[model samples]
Every structure is written in C-alpha cells, then in structure tokens.
Target: MSVHILIIDDEMNWIKTFSDILIDYQVCDAEDIFNATNLSDACEVLRNNAIDILFLDLNLGCESGQDAIQGLRAEFPNSTLVVMSGVTTGSIPLMCMERGAYDYLPKAMSTDELVLSIQKVISRVEHFDRVRFAPNDLSMVNTQLPFSSYVTQDEKLHSVFEYLKVVSMTQHPILITGESGVGKGVLAKAIAEYSRPNGPFVSLNVAGLDEQMFSDTLFGHTKGAYTNASSQRTGMIAKANGGTLFLDEIGDLSLSQQIKLLYFTQSGEYQRIGSDLIETSDAKIVFATNQNLIELIELGKFRKDLFYRLNTHHINIPPLRQRIGDIPLLIKKFVHQAAEDYAINVPHISDGLIELLKSYCYPGNVRELSSIVYNAVLKSDGQVLTFSDFEFPEIRDIESCSLNAEPETNDTSFKRLDDLFDEKIIDALRVSDGNQSKAASLLGVSQSTISRRLKKLQI
Candidate 1:
C-alpha cells in the first residue's frame, strides 16, 4: 500500500511542486491542507483518511501555524509531522519539536533530502507503532485475519481452561510454561482480559532485555535522565498499572535481572534510572516460557528465589500433540481466518483431509498447523480443502501418532456427573498447576464455581 501524505502549505506553487515530488516517489493522497485554515477543518480531513505523514507550514494566514500544528499533533499523534516552510526560523523548529513535530525540512532542500526525511520519518513511526498501541486502535479487530476461537470437549483441555478463568480474578503473578505453539501467550491474554476487561493490557518479550533497555522500557525515564532522553516517557509497566503485564519468554531473563524483577514482585515498587523516588506499580504480572526453569536452576542460570516468588500461581499449557482431537476445529478456524485475511471465500474441508491431518504428527504444534492452513488457502484451486493441498511424511509407527493412542473407533463415552465433575476439577488444578482462578477460565466457569466445587471436593 502507498503511504498517505497530507500537506498543509498556504503557497499554492509550493504545494503543487511538493505534491508532484511525493507522487514521483510513489506516495499517495498528497493533498493541500492550507485549505484547512482552522484546527477544526484540519481535524476533519485527518479523521477522514489514514494519514502516514503530515507536512505542516510554519505560518498560516492570521494564525500561528505552530499552534495549529500543536492541536493537530494531539489529535493525530500517530501520523508523522514534518515542518516544511520557506521561512528559516530556528524558533519554529524548536517550537514544533515541543509540540511533537517529527522532523523539520527546508523548502529549498533537494528532492533527495525530502525523500530521505520521509523515509526516516516512516521508519521511526513504524517502530513507535510496534512499541505503542494507540488507544483508538487498541480494540478494533484486525480485518486482515482472524485467529482460532478456543473450543473444548476433551476433559483435559476443558479442565485447564476452567482453571484459567478462576485465577484471572486475582492480582497475583502467574507463570505459564509449555512447549512452543502450545498457546502459552494466548492463555496469558485470556487471563488478562478476565482480570481487567475494560483496561489496557500490555505485553512484550523480556528475552531481549539487557540491563539498560529493561529499566527504561519497564519503569520509564524522566527527561534528561539519559543521554538521549528528550521527553518524560511512560513505560510498559506504568502503562499497564491498572491492568496486566504479560512478559513472554520469562525463562530467558538473566539471573541478575531476575533479582531486579523480584523486587517489583515483592513490593510493587519501582524507580526510574537516575531517580531516587520509588513509584509503586500495581499491574498484575503474567509470565510465560517454553523452557523448563528447573533445568535452568540446576545449571545456575536462573534464580530460585525469584522463581518461587513468580510461581505463586502457575499454569502448564498442553501441547497440540496431546490434544489431537482438537485438530479438526483448529483447522476449520484457520481456514476461515485465511479466507478473511486474503479476501477470498472460505473453502470447505473434506473428511479425508481432516483425517489425514489428525494422523500426522505436528512437530511445531498449533502454530505450524495454522501456517499449513494459510498456505493451503492460497494454493488451493478448488472450493474445498482436499488431501492434494497437503504434503506429509509416511505414517511410520503406531507410537508416532500425535495422541500416543492406537487408531480405533471414535470414542463417545461419558462419565457420571459426579465423576465428570471430579475429573474436570482435578484437570483444572493440573493445568493451572494448582492456581484456582486461571483454572476457572479454562473450564468456561466462574471462579465461584471452582471454589464451591473445591470446597465440596475438599481439594
């Protein structure tokens, strides 16, 4: 898609020249914004389009263009603002900087300089979007693709979900561990949503955190505290104060950093680097990892004390291989997702193909399965998903089956209500690793149900 550029220049000749230059560089919708003499008019245009870059003139007729830019900057903060003018006043650039103008460009500069400035602005904006979720766009479902809606009929899967539902009501830290593609992150998000349905939930992988970036990203730094710090910033931990903070790949944390994190878990207090005052953080913490921390502790790579602190509520996500019966539902969901993403009609799946998928051992688990469906959607020439769309290794041994069970007649047996209830409660406890609230979500029941059941069962 072409980048949307909005130009606000009073000089008609300059506007025309710049529009031509932007068009030559493959930018789209390079429209004159000087027609928007007032903030209200500019805002109307901004609201109408997806603007990637805004070029604002420093002076509009009878109004300080800086003030107008400041107002537009507040409303369209995600759109990069580049100050463009024939007026070479230093104060204008400084003022625009204070109002969050992305960069300054002189009208007399060559086409190369203009294009380079735009490229730099685009790069910075993409990075900013990755780290920051705009409030307006936070809840909007991405129209490109849809993901699987969790389903449960298997006793083991249902029990785990029930446990997650219950533990989500509390503010305690939750630790989730499982093989990759086992939906550890998905489970973490489900817990966050249950805890604070109306609040923001922020997530990031802590595996890349070194000492400095971790501090700045989590606790936020004040202006002038660091060499390049230009403004006071809110960190992820601060941003999610009333909600939840999901730290994926927590097992990758270094031992020393784990000690630092332990302090936050212990006392709900944090201090920005180069600051003496301690600020309290009240966000619930959810950590996930595919690695076994016990092995890390054995090798002296992980801190035992920090592990215990985070282990107050634990969850273990089961791999897809253990839940082969779910493959059909998962594949159906992925096919619909692919159809939506690619703007194509949803294709039907054959029973032969479904049986073939169930027979194969998915090494990458659900993630791999989703990818296969996505590819099949793009490659399938017919309206239905058939075995021809798939390529698989020959079935080797009965032991090689994903479920580790011999192929037999479809089992539709059921337990008595009492036995079913007991089994579900126990399975919830196992998946939650004994965390009651998280167990509740997995079971599609309220925390009270699990609590009351536990009381009756005396578990």
Candidate 2:
C-alpha cells in the first residue's frame, strides 16, 4: 500500500525536500506525492484524489492555517492532517491537536522527526485501511476480545474499548501505555484474539534483561552460537510468527536495546545473537509501559523516533482512580475468580464493604484490587467479604499524616469527598518533599493542574 501524501505549503524548497525523503523511503512515487500552495489547492487535491496524509504548513502568509484547521477537518474527515509550524511557542502544538490535527510538528524539527512524523501518519493511514468500525460504533462496549472476557460498565472504558477494537485491525505495532496493573497485557491478548484468533500469543517481560539477554530472548541464536548454546532454541518472535508478540515493561528497555527493537519494528527483520543469518517474522508487536515515555525521551533515556514508531496506534488505559465506578464490577469478577480457584462458595459483598473499598485509592490499580479480593477470600470463613478483608496501607498512612497535617495551622480532618481529594494531593506533595513537579508526576497529573488545585483549595 503506497502512501499518497499532499504537502500544502508556500515554500517550494521545503516541499521538494520533504517529497524527496518520502521517495527515498519508498513511501510513494514522485507522481503520487502532490503539492499545494495553500489550503484551497490542498482541499482541491484532497477532493480530487484519496489523499492519505495532508501536511499543512501552519503559516500560509496572509491566511491563518490555525483558523482553517477545524473547517479542513470537517470537510475532509478521512485525510489525516499533520500541522507543521515555524513557531514552536506555548500551546501551539496542543492547539493543533485540539483543532483536529492528527499530529503537530515544528518546521525546524530534525530530519529524524520529519521522517518519524511522516511514518506516524502513514501508520494511521494503514490503520484507516484496516479498521472496520463505523463512526457510530465509537461508543460500543461489552463486546470484542478483551471486553468479552472482562466485565465493565464504566463509561470511560467505552471509548477505550472501541478505539482498541479499531486499532486491533492494523498489523502495525500497537503501544498500550498506562499506569501499572491497568491490564495492558490483557488488552494485548485481546488484540491477538480479535485480529488473528488462530495465531499464537507470546509474551515477554523485558524489565531486568540486558542487551545480550534481550537479543537472545527476542531473536534465538543458532546452536553453539553462545556459551550455553548447546541446542538451537526459538525466540518469542519466531514462536509468535503469524501472531502477536507482546513486550511488557518496555519502558525499562535501555537506549541501546531500544534501537534494536526500533530497527526490528521498522523493517520486521532481525538477526539472532552471534549469528550472521538474518531472519524476518511477521509477529505483530504490542508494547506496554507504565513510565512516561515523553519525559524519558526528554531526559535522553528513550529514543524519540522509537516513541513515534510504537505510538502508531497508542491505547492509553486510564488508571483505576479515574474510573472508580467500575469497582463494583471488578470486585465481583475478582471475587468469582478467587472463589472458583479455591473451590469455595462465592461470598456475599456488602454495600458498606463496597463503599469502604471505593474510598481507598488503588495505587496498585486493578491488579492490587484482585490481590486484595483473592487474599480476603482465602482468609474469610463467613459468607460475607468485609472491610477487614481489604488492605489500604495508604489509607492508614493518610490517617496518621492527617494528625500532623498543618499541626501548627488548622486541624483539617478528612470528611467530604473534596477533603479526601485534597488530602491525597497533600500526601503526594509531602511524599515528593514539597517539590510540586515531582508531586504532579507522582499524582499522574501536570504541574500546572496541581498548581491550580492548590490555589483553588487555598492550601
């Protein structure tokens, strides 16, 4: 599938340069790559042909490209518009996204960024071809692979499920990122089941592995290739051929290992450790990570290009805190699973217990909730699972901290929901030692958001 690109800009030289790179990468031929001086011409080109990507220069001399974004998006919903700007000042990139641009890039970005940007849109275009969902199905829930096995009536997850269902159609790499225990692996398996049900689903955790180990595990070496290579062993990629290969804890991958994985993703080619023989596998790669990749890229711990590559179909699962409404459903599922595992009767859940469970913030997320329920099931001899069955170390710590919270100022005991939230924020701040930036990161929010909350609460 050749990518049809339309570069809408006044600069002839920039179009020439960009089109040349696309040709070099074999994204499309010269004839297929169209150019337009302005949005009108761009719209004409889009209307004339099925343009996969529309690269609009944020500057159009007299015309404001930012102002035209919403109109362009409305007129050409299928064409993915990537807004490029000369001005990289505050909130402009965010504004482009808000205004319906698929991606935003600075005009002065490196050749690498440009290539990655183009690749990102191409990835989406390929996704457009693969995705079978209609627009009306955006709110679809309670169906599909992962959702079929699990139970949830949370409104927030409706969008997540629908998005995943669409993304699962694409053969390109899918990146599932979220806080820990948000079921990234489960979604990856669902992708496999939905996309290629008969194919194998192989998973590998790359948390503690070094470069040599990572390569050896992902790409098997031939017999006698290494010290312990007495027999030839197949790697996860080979094992998952024609299927899905899930790489968990991908954030822990070192910079060098990231480069290797990036290359494999780009080319679908790899060579086993100490073996000159190159191999290719059609294993659909699925990556999961809890770390903030963009921050890691800024800190030079992660590659920017790799980030874009894996972000082809990024599916971010909101943590348990954001979707607390699903606690009852999740609790029910966990309880049944625990009872089935123990070969015991399913204990009754009290409304008071539900309230108590919902009050404590789940730092460990759904995984932690399951552990609590399972452990409680094992301990309880009666018919009901009570509040004593659950563990909330943070709640206990907060209670202790409230005694010393503003000891010199005011005695603010947690009472209302607002107070509980404020206490949570204060606890995060204290844990981060009054560093607002660190506190924001700990709370999984922006520093500005925390600042606003602090000001509003007068804390």
Candidate 3:
C-alpha cells in the first residue's frame, strides 16, 4: 500500500540527500525507492515497476531535462512527474507544467519545502485514487439512483461531474444555482448518494414556508407547538442527521426565514417550536435555487449576510440550451423510461426529430424536454416517432408570423416595413417572455442577431 517514488538525477550526492529526506519523513517505504542516473535507466525502472511519483532533475550534465519529459510520460503515463533543477531561469517550469509535469521545484529549496511539495503531490494522488475507485466499493449497487443515470455526453458536464465527485468527499455546504429544471436537485441527490450513502437523505422546498413554518419544518416542533401540532415532530435537519439535507427553491425564503436558517447553519444549533432546548445537527446542507440571489439581495428581498454565508462553495448548473450535445442522450433515456413506465414497447426516434428538438431553446430545460418525449411516446401508435407527434407551440407561432408577413414594394412602403418588423420582434419577445435567447430561437435567428435588431430598432 506504500507509495513508490523514483528519483532520476546524475548527481549522486543530490540523489542520496533527497532519498534520505524522503525516507526519514516516511514519504513512502524505503525499500520502494528507486534511483536512475539518466533517462535510459529511468525508463527501464518505469517498465519494471509502477512509480507513483517521479522526481526528474532537468539539468542532467550533458542531457536536456525537457527531452526526458516526453519519454517518461510515454512510459509512465500514470506517474506524477515533478521536475527539479538548479537552473531557475527562462520558462522551464512552465514548459514542464505544459508537458504534464505535476509540479516543479528548485534544487535550492530547503528539505522542509521539498517535503511539503512531496506531501502535496501525495495528497492529490490519494484524493484522485479515492474518487476514482470509490464507485466499486461504495453503496452505488444498493442505491436505486445510480450516478451513471445522469445522461450527459458533453465535456463541460463531465467536468462538472468530476468537480461534484471531489467536493462530495467533504461536508462543506454547497449552493447550487441555475435556471429552473436544470437538474440542481438531481445533482444534490447524486452528491448525497456518493458522500453519505448509508445515511438518510431528506429534502424540503423552502419556497412557501413562512418564518414559523420554516422553523417548524427545519427545526422540528414540540407537542402543542401550534394549532395542528398534537405530538412531537422531527424536522428535516434532525431527519437528515449524519446525511444530507437538500433545500430546494432556497431563493424564495423570506428575509426573516433566511436569518433563522443562517443562524442554524452558522452555529449548528436550533431551537424547536414550543421548546427552549437548543439542539445541534450534523447534516450536510445543500441549497439550490433558480432565482438570482444577488439581484434579490440588491432588491432587499434576501439577506446579504445569508448570501455571503451560503456562497462559500457554489456550482452553477448550465442550462439545457447551452449543452445541446446532451439533448439526444437525454431524449433516448427519457423515452425508454417512459416506455417502461407505460408498459409499452420502446419507440424508435428519428434523426429528423432529434435535429428539430436540438434547434429549439428549452426554456424549461431538461424537465421540459423529458415531458415532451414522454407525451410524444404516449400519443404515438407506431413504433417510430416523427416530428408530427411533437407539439412545439413556439415553432408554430414563428411559422405563423412568417406566413402572415407581406413583401414591401417601394420606398414609400419602407416605413410600413419598419413598423411590421418592430411588431414581429415585439411578438417574439412576448412569446419568449422577454428572454432574448428563447426569442432568437423562435425567430430562427442567433441571439446576437436578436440583440442587434433590438438595439437598431430601438425597441
């Protein structure tokens, strides 16, 4: 289980001193240490053993340090390569990093600093291994909602998934913000499944909860606390102890309610309704919202202090329109799921239908697309689905607008044409509820084009 490290340097004294430092600091098992005076011997050692970390001296007498990086990387792709040299001029360190070196250290650094650098690399390697290998041993097999079910082929989404995996290992409070139906809640659940698989996962929508209701729901209520309280009750914080407590629609919370929630989060203590006893919870807090909290804070609807507290670790889920590559995969998954739920055969989707689905700006995001697919499948009699089964009201409106327009004839008609153009733009804006991107989709134009027209027309 001990880490294996290889030191490649031509200087015997440097190699001996660094090896002694590593061994004395218990960086890894002393027997696991390997040394090579040049790239040839280093490659041979790499071929024979798996080196977790490789310390390569860039200034090897007659040899160039940069020349060895590619060869070492080719042979030991998994090893964390650290370039060290007495020469600190030029872009050597940057070049090493660009060529995939884990870190660069100066040979003049003290032993303590060298130990710290080695420790940092080891920590990162261990974290990566933990996250990478966790899926096999974690409670993923027992959970109904597996991480793989979140259908995404986009590189950005994959990176987001990786970030989520790394952050899930910690108990930091996460604030997830995005447009409605962008799957913030789903991501939160995925985090909980990975981070606290054995513990309970509780959720609550804090939108409509007044101060009293928020308190009763989040901090629990004692017997005879209110008109409907007949017995003792446990709230979400208590129920989610040792696990995750996801609060959806967090932006809708009242300012007073925000203060109370912030107090609980800051102090980890809360008082139940009708009880003077203070209680503490160990639940991991995950908050999500569709609204812009900064705007709300500027408008005095949300507390600034609470916003600062919750903004520590924030993730912005990109909307479906932004990640169009994921549309087809999501469509297929939703269609199959719907077919299974309806006890019918899975319907075949056409390439044309998929293309049409990709063109539209899904304002309601993934949830809207899922609903469209499910409805089409239910209404379809044939095995293969076509565009006829899909009802896009926005598309119809755009078509109607185009069909109703008349051609301008002369210079005298230019004024009328301008008026008509303004009317059409206004109509598109109205159809899209003032969302310029959605309006652009409705008009079959780019968002930038819409913005230019809006500015030119002075609308």
Ranking by TM-score: 2, 3, 1
Better of 2 and 3 by TM-score: 2
* Candidate 1 residue lDDT tens string, 66-106: 77777777788668777887766434554565466656678
RMSD of each: 22.6, 11.5, 13.0
Q: 1-459, model 2: which lDDT tens digit per residue?
A: 877888988889989988888888777899889999888888888899988888888888788888989998889877888888787765566566656777878878888878887886787677656553454444555654446665567775675676677677767799888888878888788788877788899999999998888988998888999788998878888999998999999999999999999999999999887678889999888999999887686678888778868875677787776677888888988888999899888987765456546655566778888888898887665366644455443333334333123112233432464555576567667666788886665444578978988999987
Q: Model 3: which residue pairs collide?
A: none
Tell me model 2's lDDT, rounded to 2 decimals. 0.77
Taking the tens digit of each residue's C-alpha lDDT, what string does model 3 give over 1-459? 478999999999998999899889999877989999988888899889978889999877788877778777766777878898887765566566556576778989998998998897887668666766776543333223446656776665565566566667766688899888888888888888888989889989988887777888898899998897989999889999999999999899887788888998898899889999999998889999999876786688888668756764578877787777889888988889889999999987755456656755665778888888888888775376754466543222222223124223344433343444455556667656799886655544578977888898876
User: What CA RMSD would candidate 3 show?
Assistant: 13.0
TM-score: the better of candidates 1 and 2: 2
Q: 436 in model 2: Cα distance from truth in Å?
A: 41
Candidate 3's C-alpha runs over 4 A off are 1-146, 393-459
Candidate 1, run of 10 with poorest lDDT: 139-148
What C-alpha lDDT does candidate 3 achieve relative to the native structure?
A: 0.76
